[model samples]
Target: MKKLFLLLLFTVVVLVACASPYDPAPQLLPSYVKNVYVRPVVNNTNQYGLEDKFTKAIIDEFMRDGRLSVVTTEEEADGVVVCEIKRYVLQPLTYDENMVTEQYKLWVLINVFFIDKHENVTLWAEPNMEGIQIYADSVKGGFGGMTEEEAREYIWEKLARDIVKRTIKGFGSTGGISERKVQD
Candidate 1:
């Protein structure tokens, strides 16, 4: 009986080890959502012109992706992408011996929603979507560092890519902030 039990345990272990890894297929957006209108991004932070740059980045990303037609008006679109810049933070990550900031971290937080205009329902909502970058100061570090504007541009590109991926690939591509932080 002991030999039989050991054999059974070994068989179970072998079967488990031989099992194929599960990979979930990416979920695509609804077939009806062939076109989208990106509303002008709203900036809540004191930073100036961030809305324009971010909005342009998103538009450019959609155009580059070629998966969805970008429409000029909501009426012409099957879906609408709503974006709002909620927060922007720049902090010193490391300081030099002189107490000067040598390295900095930039963070941009946003809320994104893709609504099915025909159904009058939001198909997907990403609240507190964020893009972050860390770099050394150009004057203090060995490697030439990016200016604040350059850092902002980098963040815009990252966010635009994420937004596009979330729209085209649907769930599990990216994670938003904790649900507890999101308010109605």
Candidate 2:
């Protein structure tokens, strides 16, 4: 009987140790941000399709984060986030004799701002966020010969993920929430 009681107590202690600790200071997440407005991105670059692509990327990031309930229109949203595409350029890469050993490099620059409805304050502003992606081309094809649409697609996915990660990290840091790791 004594042995059984000791075993039970040990098991309970181990179970409790394995559980996660409850956060004492839970950050106040805005309940009013139940809906979000994603405005159309203003494109300053000559690139034709950059505006739509960047706009969709930001919306998708917000949706995937699961923290904010996103809405399409401003009328239904509590706040609005506006994004601008400042630059999109493709620079050619040339080798000996200007044979164009490699394909063009695509660079993208963006700016984002978030606004609150009731307080009428800008929550966040990130200017000059940039990303670069490169693709290779065959010798037979010149820089202009290879289509970079597929490359853009791949790069956009990665860029969107990075943007979300940065946003989350910034939120946590600014909210004064610290993450600590426990060793096994």
Best by lDDT: 1
Tell me the tens digit of each residue's lDDT in model 2 across 63-90: 9887777786777777677778788887
Candidate 1, which segments miss by more than 4 Å at Cα?
Answer: 1-24, 139-142, 172-184
TM-score of 1: 0.81
Each candidate's number of clashing pairs is 0, 0
- In terms of TM-score, which candidate is strongest? 1
Error of 2 at 143 (Å): 15
What's the lDDT for residue 142 in model 1?
41
Q: Model 1: which ten-residue window has the lowest total lDDT? A: 175-184
C-alpha local distance difference test of each model: 0.85, 0.67
Q: Per-residue lDDT of 1-184 in model 1, one digit per residue for the tens? A: 9999999999999899889666666667888889999999999999888999999999999999999999999789998888999999999998878899988999999999887776776777888999999987776654979777888899999999999998897754444212332223
TM-score of every model versus the real structure: 0.81, 0.64
